[model samples]
Target chain A: MQLTNRSKQVSNKEMTMAEKMYLPSIVQGLAITIKHFFMKKPTIQYPEVKRYLGPVFRGHHVLKRDEQGRERCTACGLCAVACPAEAISMVAAERKKGEENLYREEKYAAVYEINMLRCIFCGLCEEACPKQAVYLRHDRMVPVFLERDDIVYGKDKLVERLDDRYVRMNSEVKATPTEPSLTKAAT
Target chain B: MDLTVLLVKGLIILVIFGITLLIATYSTYAERKVAAFLQDRLGPNRAGPFGLLQPIADAGKMFFKEDFIPAQASKWLFILGPCLAMLTALMSSAVIPFGDSIRLAWDGTNYDIPMQAIEINIGVLYIFGVVSLGVYGIMVGGWASNNKFSLLGAIRAASQNISYEIALGLSLIAILMMTGSLSLRAIVNEQATFFEWNVFTQPLGFIIFLTCAFAECNRTPFDLPECETELVGGYHTEYSSMKLGFYLFAEYINMFVSSAFISSLYFGGYHYPFMNAVHDGLTGSLGEIAGHNIATAIGTVVFFAKIFFFIFFFMWVRWTIPRFRYDQLMNLGWKSLIPLSILNVVVTGAGLLYDIKYTTWLIVVVMVVLALTSNARAPKSQAAPQRA
Candidate 1:
């Protein structure tokens, strides 16, 4: 039974003296390697030149902020429940009387941590978020962690900075078209 | 010997030593670069521009590495092994004629100093002896390690070197018979013209010597002694730190020396095509002394160029050919190369008796006819029997 036409029959014939000499074959091999010696090398100088990951690629996690720079997460535990790796944890706290500018909702996350070592970067937390707060940034990747303490990222690392906003590529095309209200709320 | 001559010779020796070491050091880098290039990848370019400082970095690393000697190992012999290897490797270069004499005027006396460390009458024999002794380094190192693999490796090395050295010496004898001299400088002097190069006369001998040299140096395709897959770093398995570095450095030095030897012996060392014409022309234009010195300088450069090409060829072959199975290597060395070299010697002797030009042409014709006839007669593989 032939699997493909590329398969060749194994020959057990005695080698000719010419073949046994190995000089001709060695010259042929040398010719081949010399050709490759001048050929263009395909090595990418990695640290200096990073390859562009596609737009939909899930990478480092980011907690969103509102237009007014208020925290968008409402201390909701839906993202934690949705995470397949169970990598997310949070502490909820009530919004203070004069903290409306700081908190977008009555309740706020006092502490939010994501174990990057455990998280699979599946973007499920982004999907399960009701407040449009959790997102996996397409442009940035989670840097390699050196210590045990560095792997579990808290609000300091995860929260979106006011000056540096996380923007999605073609949000209208990627997001569900049926959910107009969610899109409007996100904008 | 005058004190000034001694001083000059000492300086020349120092220069040769420095060059040998420098070439050996950079060979490691060149080996990596060539390997990477052959595989279509960039080699080391991190340390400095094109990783020029890589060998220096490697030396530093070797120096910093822990000097380890196993409790069960023979300590003194283990230490002596690398030193012996390096010593023999360095010693072989002393007899190689780098170029013709350079005229140096010193203390109101003109001295024509030959560009060789020691112009001994028995340069070829000395080289052969040193090369043979090189295997002892591997053997001692492997044996002293007290490991089964190292012992096997050492045994392989000893047997391999002994077997190949016969063919190596025999192949050389064809050229020695033609030149009728054992001195390397004499052999080089005989092949002053391009066509007169020993390679043209003794092509078979050159091929055999090259194969033997590969086997002698333990380069890939003939590196059975240090078959890393089987021997786990071979003779240097139990070695660490600068000791292991010494073993590796010695191999490179051996490679460099063999390249130089090949250049001097077969390719006509310090001799280029129309060299006499060039020397005469230069002599007519410039003064005699200046022309002669410039010509000698050019010849030296040409000799070095030949050595460099051969070194590259060595690396090229290393990357191209796969390691030979032990039996195959033995078969080639003993059955094929040895017999071929013996035939080459007989042919050379016959050529000398008759017209060498006619004899060489006759041999070429015979080889071509034999190849054609063999190819025509070679049986094709029979088709597999069809199932009933």
Candidate 2:
């Protein structure tokens, strides 16, 4: 029934006068702290310097667009359904004939919102999307919200702009004009 | 005293006052910085460059905080507490000789101005009296609060100070025996050379004094009175705003005065190695007046440097050692330090009769032999308990 070798038997024996003095131990402790005083500090000054989060890091959410820069989402409720935190919500609207350039499909999301406070950043919504519409960006994190109202992100904040698009570093997906996906979808 | 002397004395007092406050203020910042460095972290760099303005920021915060007092607290004594603490802390620096005298010629008459606020024959006694009075501040504040915890803390502080003061005084007696004077300036002048420092002659006494100083200042390892873990802010629990600031500031001031006293008493004060050579060279090159003044200036700077080192040492020990238990603290002060200091005094007395150098060597030899014998007698390793 012997335990691990690491267990130390507590000594109840009388301490030597030297041990009782505590000066030697105090000197040893001071030496340790003085050594640490000169050692390199591992603190990273935040705001000025940031540690690199890996490519798979789930961060801020983004609503992507098609090759032609049209909204990729077809107002599908799958993401909202798949969200464990139930953070995502949207309103579907049928696309008008004149707005074909704006919507990639016959149906589009008119209003999309995600409560950042509730969203667990589990990437479940990203996995549930039929089209590659929603993704948690690896590069940027959601800025800290100051107001309660600011915690709920709307389409205006999430939608990807054509000029400055969100690109996944590890993915082969691109928005080149030579791509035939838009024509295939139209046909 | 004439008008010029009065003016000079006034100027010196003002300078000393400014310096004490300045050092106390920066000691807070330094304490934080040192604590951080020891713990391998960068502390307080945002307020200003290297957080140099952190003390100012802290003072501003203290001033703006709402002044508070417990309803059950005695209002008058509560107000008097921090004032007394601060007053006593400031008063102790008056007799410390910062440097050699500055000679001035006015109205065809020569006058010499000592770089001290006031010269008193009983400087050491004055310092001890002021330091002892410092405890009254804590006691009054704690008692006035009418809180059980505060009262306990105050009691602890009072008892701790009283206990350690004996050892501290006994340790000083060894030095006094050597120098034959209680005046701090005389003590410094006695140790005019590097090797002649009291630390060399009375190493045992220096150790005891240092330990007692740490306890008397209510620093870590002897800081049971204000220990947050047990006493919940301790003696100043009921104080708020600038009153709390005053209590905290008074501690730093006490630390400053203690460092200065330690420097002046034990470490050769303004005297440095090869000071004679430096003085001679300066005087030989420049005229006597200019050279003497410059030398004095250097000595003052050196004195300040020693004080700073001791201050840093105080913080160093704080960060290094954990606080002592109440019983352990008492045992060390009453049992260990007191007896050791008494021994130190006897040894110093004996040394004065014989050769001091021989006596010091003998003590060292005895201590080494005792340590070796103790190590040899210790059981090598107790066999591990047999498993059930």
Most DockQ-accurate candidate: 1
Local error of candidate 1 at B385, Å? 12
- Residue range A1-187, candidate 1, lDDT tens digits: 6555565567877877667768878999999999999999899998888888766778889998988889999978999999999999999999999999998999999999999989999888888888888888777899988898898999999999988887774544463322223342453
Per-residue CA lDDT of model 2 for A84-140, tens digit only, reads 999999999999989999999899999999999999998888888888788788788
Compute the lDDT for candidate 2. 0.88
DockQ of all candidate complexes: 0.52, 0.49
TM-score of 1: 0.92
Model 2 docking grade: medium
- Local error of candidate 2 at residue B221 (angstroms): 0.8
Give me the runs in candidate 1 sitting further than 4 Å from their true place: A1-8, A84-86, A145-149, A170-187, B106-109, B284-286, B355-361, B381-388
Q: Model 2: residues >4 Å from true position, as ranges?
A: A1-9, A147-149, A171-187, B107-110, B355-361, B383-388
Model 1 chain A lowest lDDT segment of ten? A175-184
